[model samples]
Target: MLPKGFQYAGVYAGLKDNGKKDMGVIVSERKAVCAGVTTTNLACAACVKRARKILRRGAAKAIIVNTKYANACTGKQGERDDAEYAKIAEKLFGGPVLTASTGVIGQNMPLDNIRRGAELLKKELRDDYDAFAEAILTTDLVVKKISKTVQILGRDVTVAGVAKGSGMIHPDMATMLAFITTDADIDRGLLQRIIREVTAISFNQITVDGDTSTNDMCLCLANGLSGVRIDRQALPIFQAALTEVLIYLAKAIAADGEGATKLMEVNVTGARSLKEARLAAKAVAGSPLVKCAVYGGDDNWGRVIAAVGRSGARFDPEKVRMNWDGLQSKTVTINIDLANGRESAQAWGCDLTEGYIKINTKYN
Candidate 1:
């Protein structure tokens, strides 16, 4: 289900040879309070820069996205192309626009094709959520989306989101694009705070190939059409609902990791601080040896222990405890007791397999 007062469309404009949808647009009837978290990588895409600038103004009316040609490392031309696309979209949608692109880096975006795509998208505008989801995917095998309704201030508030990612994923923003929409009224500052906090526990706690991409980003738009004001008293409920939606999409991305057969959940407990817990959890999740062991269904607690030991988190080895109660299921959970403090954190990932190598190596 889509949030209120928004329209979506996805159309092909000669970007992909296979005729798959390569461009998508989401427009809100009213200017929406927007917040976004983007790739921390130094070689970020031009669209990332543009989006950040637009978001700093505090509101946006639409988001234009394209897949199959990340506008990264193309120098000034890439930046100009991004601006051009935004201009085209803003003119058509008649409001401020944010843009995002994903796919192979170091290539120039085909602006002419994208302009054509913008026209097609305008003509195709509808509530076709699935088409928008499909248009943002590169190597993902399935669509990742979620929707939930919560009662806030005696009003029904809806939160819906869509995401696309399969590989080149890691913490500090994975190689993915996610757009979250809501109808609850939230202040810009509060919305930004909630997005950052939720991302730390969700998108920032997942890994696929331990590589961050240049075009990764997660954006949230709140149009307040539901007439539900999320004041301080109602923040907790809204935050919980947002976190649930993001975590569901994040786990879905991990579970659908390229050629993965199992979803791996790493839990680090007894840490001295939240940072240490997150470090240990991410280390365990990104460890290739641990992932391979999980793939082969091996009870190799040693790999998990080794990952934690080198994670820069101080802990006594002898006092550490390991559990693998999830071995019998497709979802494997590895629990680590650091025996250092009371804090705990979790990270999600996927098992490594030979198929992963094949898919990446053969990818054009």
Candidate 2:
């Protein structure tokens, strides 16, 4: 079930040639505390630029999204278009709207179509989770969403998230597009801090082709509908629930990577620091050679070792040890030991296959 104070809607705005649902919005029953993490690419999209500014206000009533025209690298007009779209949404659905978009990077958004979509969405808002999840996807094979309820202050506090990503997925700020909603009352600064910390170990740990998108972002809203107030004493429970939702969606994105047949997980332990462990884990997971070995079931452990060595993590080569689950399964895990200290980290990616080559050759 969705969080109590939120409503969703998805409709076709003619941005996509396939006539699929390409536009969506999530509206909270009242003003909600909002937090967001966005792409670090210098050439990021207009939506990312605008959302960064809006997130600082720490409050919003709705989020409007569209796919099939990223509105990136389009010059000043793109920024104007993104602002205009938000204005249209605010005009119809009230004030303080955030926006997100994905798809081809250089095209300008169709303002007229977006206006029509906003008008339709005004009358279509409902609790149809699947519809909004499906609308945000581009190359994803299936919808990715999760909901969990935790006990907080003797009340049921719900946290829910939905994500969309298939290609151009790597983490600098956050990967692709994800939206989270919670019914727990939370401070805006605390919510932002939690999002950043969780994203580092979740979305920031996944890779698909190692190509970070120009429009990547993750946003969270807390409307306090559950009447459960979160303070330092109760923060752990709420953060843990949010972590579960984000990590589930992250793994879903990796497993659904374009033309990928299996998920590959890398675990690194016994490092001198968490940063070093993370560096080692991500190095192995993002290595195309290691991914190809997993795809072919080649059992080539040398590639993994080579990646770790070049990963800039300090560790003695003689102390390193490796183990692997059979590569033939739908999920493969690689275990490694730096044998240096107690720090550890994990990363996720998908096996590289010939299908990947085929899909990208005509991606445009």
161-278 in candidate 2: lDDT tens per residue? 9999765321122238999999889999999999999999999999987878789999998999999889988899999999999999999988998789999999999999999999
In model 1, the Cα lDDT at residue 125 comes to 88
For each candidate, give its TM-score against the true structure.
0.96, 0.96
Which residue pairs come into collision in candidate 2? Answer: none
Model 1, C-alpha of 183: deviation from truth (Å): 0.9
Assess each prediction's global lDDT (C-alpha) against the native: 0.87, 0.88
Off by over 4 Å in 1: 167-174
Off by over 4 Å in 2: 168-175
Give the best candidate by TM-score.
2
RMSD to native, candidate 2: 2.5
| Candidate 2 TM-score to native | 0.96
Q: What's each prediction's clash count?
A: 0, 0
lDDT (Cα, tens digit) per residue for candidate 1, span 1-364: 5678988889888887778898999999899999979989999999999888877887999999988778789899999888898999999996789898887777788889999999999999886577888888777788898888898767788888999976532112236889999988999988998899999999999999988889889999999999889998888999999999999998999998888889999889999999999999999989999999889888798898899989988898999998985776789999999999999999999999987886776444
